[model samples]
Target: MSKYDPLSGHLRRQREDELELTFAEIERILGAMLPKGAARQQWWANTTDPHTSHVQRKSWRGAGYDAFLIAGKERVRFKRVR
Candidate 1:
């Protein structure tokens, strides 16, 4: 199981269309610290290409959500995909 599986499960249980979480909060959910790359917007890109898919990307996408970085906020907004 990927370390991000917990994040996927968390997102799957959410009913909100849009959920915003601080980086610290996400780290709490994952029970680990985020990589430095998380500070880069590209790290949150919804890359669907399997060859390039990372565990973090797979987590949110699998849960029918897309993640967007909240600039200057140290947070991310997860929007449920219709």
Candidate 2:
């Protein structure tokens, strides 16, 4: 299962198309601690389905959302696209 599945369901229930969440919040949704430097680099590179490859760098696309960083990478904002 993709780490973003839980978060996808949460956002869908909220009826929100665009939302931002802190790294801590993301961890809670994923039910695991994020890898080091998760708030940096290309963590927002959501293009491919994460379940397709456990080592893939793709972000939220597996959950049907496009993601990007905000507040200088302090938070992530995901926009529903599917």
Candidate 3:
């Protein structure tokens, strides 16, 4: 299983339509630090194309959510999309 599976599981367990979390909070859920790339807004794209190398996309997208970066802030907003 991918390390990000924990994040997917966490999202799956949420009852809110939308959830906002600081990068630190996500790291806590993953039990590891996010890669440096995570600081880039484009890195948080909601792209779900199977061929994409952005594996983290599967965590939220597979959990029926889409990820949106909170510009200038180290936070991400996850909105249920499915």
Candidate 4:
């Protein structure tokens, strides 16, 4: 049997609901990951509901982008296209 085993399948099934990435950090990382002049966007806010004011009860969406709730840390990873 091959020694290399892919973890993506396992990780995907056991995925957590939250992640964290700093704006600058993600930007830099994505920048390096993506080519120059690629369009990159980010959105963030307190993971609380405006109406209920309950923590972990709300989330906001950004146009042309997807959002992830990263608990405990303030960072995320993303992809961009040129």
Highest TM-score scorer: 1
* Candidate whose lDDT is highest: 1
lDDT of 1 by residue, 31-67 (tens): 9999999999999999778877588999999999999
lDDT of each: 0.93, 0.66, 0.92, 0.31
Model 4 ranges with Cα > 4 A deviation: 1-14, 32-82
**How does candidate 3 score on lDDT?**
0.92
Could you list the CA RMSD of all candidates, in the order they appear? 0.9, 3.3, 0.9, 14.2
Worst 10 residues of 3 by lDDT: 46-55
lDDT of 2 by residue, 1-82 (tens): 5675676666656567788889889789778887766666475566565354533234355445677778566788878885
lDDT of the structure predicted as candidate 4? 0.31
Ranking by lDDT: 1, 3, 2, 4
Q: In model 2, which regions exceed 4 Å deviation?
A: 48-59, 71-73
For every model in order, what is the number of clashing pairs? 0, 0, 0, 8
TM-score of 2: 0.67
Clashes of 1: 0
Minimal lDDT window, size 10, model 2: 50-59
Please tell me which model should have the higher TM-score, number 1 or number 4. 1
- Considering lDDT, which of the candidate structures 1 and 3 is the better prediction for this target? 1
TM-score of each: 0.94, 0.67, 0.94, 0.23
